[model samples]
Target: MPEFAPIHLLYLALAIVLEIAANVLMKFSAGFTRKLPAMTAIVCALAAFTALSYAIEGIQLSVAYGIWGGVGLIATAILGITLFGERLRPSGWLGLALILGGVVLLKFS
Candidate 1:
């Protein structure tokens, strides 16, 4: 794997945040029926992809995407529980743990 500059890591983190925000906005957009939130989600998704593209330049593509998706899934799950009153089964928690483990393994690999 290539050495990622601090700025690249920052961009990757921001991309993750933007992606999560886009998901939340897309949910609120109600299948893109609402104009403002839908547009915001589009913008967020575009920005997130752009940042993630930059991230892959410094980090390995597979590793960057693994960590990106894994962390995003965990964060989104937590946010869903808090914001939407969603429930997580024991198995769901275990799945989250597995995702974290996969990310760790990807990092070490």
Candidate 2:
């Protein structure tokens, strides 16, 4: 297989951002009761998936998915804590750390 290019990583980054935005919009959707946020969330999620598909064309699926999910989870958790007044337990912090480490390893592998 050909080595991954910088553009693939950029696509992955875009995917991650869009995914996070989708998640936040979904939260604002109030169980899909809010039409605008709910619809926008769906659009953002579809776009994110499209970007992820492009990223996987160059990057290994495992690495691309690992980083995509790990970073998305980490960022969403931070947003939840800050924007939603959510709290994470000590174990949750540890889990986030493990996820970060896994993403780092995947990037270098």
| Top candidate, metric TM-score | 2
lDDT, candidate 1, 43-106, per-residue tens: 9999999999999888888988998899988998898899889999999999999999999999
TM-score of each: 0.94, 0.95
lDDT of 2: 0.96
Question: What lDDT tens digits, residue by residue, belong to model 2 across residues 1-109?
Answer: 3467999989999999999999999999999999999999999999999999999999999999999999999999999999999999999999999999999988888
Against the true structure, what is every candidate's RMSD?
Answer: 1.3, 1.7
Native-referenced Cα lDDT, model 1: 0.91
TM-score of predicted structure 1: 0.94
Superposed Cα deviation of residue 37, candidate 2 (Å): 0.5
Candidate 1 ranges beyond 4 A from true positions:
none
